[model samples]
Target: MAFHAHPDDEALATGGTLARLAAEGHRVVIVVATDGVVRDAPGAALRARLDELRASAAVLGASRVEHLGYADSGHGAELYPDPPGRTRFVRADPREATARLAEIIRAEQASILLSYDVNGGYRHRDHLRVHEVGRLAAQQTGVRLLEATLPRELTVRAYTALEWTGLVSGHNRQALQHGFTPRAEITHRLDVRGYARQKRDALAAHGSQLRKGRVAPLVRLLIRLPAPVFGLALGREYFIEPGAARTGKPSRQIIPPAGQG
Candidate 1:
């Protein structure tokens, strides 16, 4: 199960991984935590975007798509005063959200659960709530794999070095400026280079939110980067497994390139 805050998030963050898993015959499900109404897109426009999401899921080979029916909590200042009749995700009861997600996990019999990091990858309030609900649902369901982004020490080091050398530019700088957490704590890195094209196509399917002119080139560039470079130094997806037995020492679940098998 891939838990995302909104429609486009699954494409942005886990498209590659999800596509690869589905291609390998793994049953994959996407749980969208919100309706993504923050952008002020018309009701019909949002529904169209969701239909696009479903189409993208098909391209990604997802077996199912689940909507938690939560509302998008607009970014930062926009969240204040709770927009008229719109549902506010930040103020939604976490317990209720967790219960909803937990039910989905049970229904799907999800062995693995993937979600954004605690920082929401960019500190979006809805993203943070997804993280919290994911953690709680994982605990409740005893899912064997809980995939999430963690702050990666090496990524931080690389960013710092780049900043010192004045090489950080474009989107990298924008990421820094916006306080996005791109360097996550990686635990498992699946080599998605084989499915990179499918991932790109899946991303493209989110037409309403991802305008082709704006994101296509960047997606192309990202797909072209060597797989090793793509995962940064971690070169593996990361996760924190709940209820796993601890041996009084950290486990070496972090997959190196040679260990991707």
Candidate 2:
């Protein structure tokens, strides 16, 4: 199962891996911690985001999809007020959140849970919460945990390329500097080049993010790239095991063999 902060996150961070796994006959489940709604933000509706997430998940071949029932805290300072009855994910009780996720882990019988790195890949409040809740829930359920991330240097290079094409207009150049895990710390680097087209399709499914500046120009540029260029740039996915076993050159599988474990 892959657990993420938002709708497009699965497509951007682990889409290829999820697609590859499902194509390989493994049951892939996509779960999000938030509905990714901010009432004041343009084109950011809860139902729209959830629909987009389901569409994206379908493209990635996820057999099932779920939300943990929380509101998007959004990025930057000044958290928005929670919608009607829901609480902002960042303000929810950790133990309660952990329990909710733990229940899913048990129900799914997942062998491993994929989530964000310790810094939540950019320190977004909701992503940070996902990292924490995922780790705790996986532990509670006796499942392995793989924290999805990019080598800090890779993110920097990506931002630079995006900047050159003006695709990252108004985006911070140094945003990738601090939050990602380092290359040396990454335990798995799965090559998903063969599934690049599917990955691209999955990303394209989240049309709201692409239309609104919510995700901005970076994704816009990505979907526009030719197949080969997109594959070369984003065909590989990264992850860290966080104290889990490591043996025999970081196996390519997201869920390593039982012997390896």
Candidate 3:
């Protein structure tokens, strides 16, 4: 089960990995913590976004897609008020959220639970809350834990270059201050280059966000690239498992054998 903070996060972060696993006959599932509803997009727009999410999941070959039933926690210098009738993920009770997520983990009998790293990739409050809640859910369910993250050195170098190239905005660059996990700290670096098509298709399925400008410009550029170029850019996904020693090289896969943890 892969747990994400929002709709497109699964695709942007681990879509290729999920596609590969699903294609290998593994039952892949995606669980998101929020509706990705930061603003008051028309009700129809929100419904369409959900539909798009399901479409994306189908493209990735996921067996199930579940939402934890929370609202988005807006990001940026100015905090936006939560939409009426919904609680932002950052404001939700962590214990309650974890309990609900634990139920899903138990129900799925999932061996692995994917969440976000300590820094939540860019210190997004909702993503950080996801990290905390996901940890608790793993502890409660005894599922193996894997947190999604990028290699710190890679992120810094690549983004710095992108900034220099004028591809990244100052605001987005500033958000990277919290940092990603160093290469030595990453436990898995699954290569999903072969399933890039599935990843790309899944990413495109979230058309509303792509059209509405919900994702970062970098992501938009990636999705718009030719298939081969897109694969080359995001062929691998990185992860860290708490308490696990870093291997000399990244593991090709995340799941252990049926009898293993």
Per-residue lDDT tens digits for candidate 1, residues 1-261, read 899988877866777777767766678899897776665556786677678889889988898998777667776465644444555677888888889888988988876888766566656778878878888887788875554554445445556665564445344444443442333324444555565555666766776654443344445555456645654532333454444444553344332232246
Per-residue lDDT tens digits for candidate 3, residues 1-261, read: 999998888998899888887877678899988888777767786777778889999999999999888888877656577777777888889998999899988998997898999989878888889889989998888999999999877777677888775767566665675566878889999888888888988888887676555345666777888888888988889999999986588786887533445
lDDT of each: 0.66, 0.85, 0.84
Best-to-worst ranking by lDDT? 2, 3, 1
Q: Distance (Å) between predicted and true CA of 110, model 3?
A: 0.8
Candidate 3 lDDT trough over 10 residues, lowest sum: 210-219
Best by TM-score: 3
Writing each residue's lDDT as its tens digit, candidate 2 over 1-261 gives: 999988889999999999888887778999898888755534437778889899888888898999999888988678878777788899999889889888888998998799899989978889999999998898788888999998898788877776677666436656678878988788898999999998998999988888786456778878988867889989999999999566656657676433444
For candidate 2, give the lDDT of residue 50: 89
Pick by TM-score: 1 or 2, better one:
2
lDDT of 1 at 192: 58
> Which wins on lDDT, candidate 1 or candidate 2?
2
Model 2: lDDT to the true structure: 0.85
Residue 247, model 3: Cα distance from true site in angstroms = 3.6
Best-performing candidate as measured by lDDT: 2
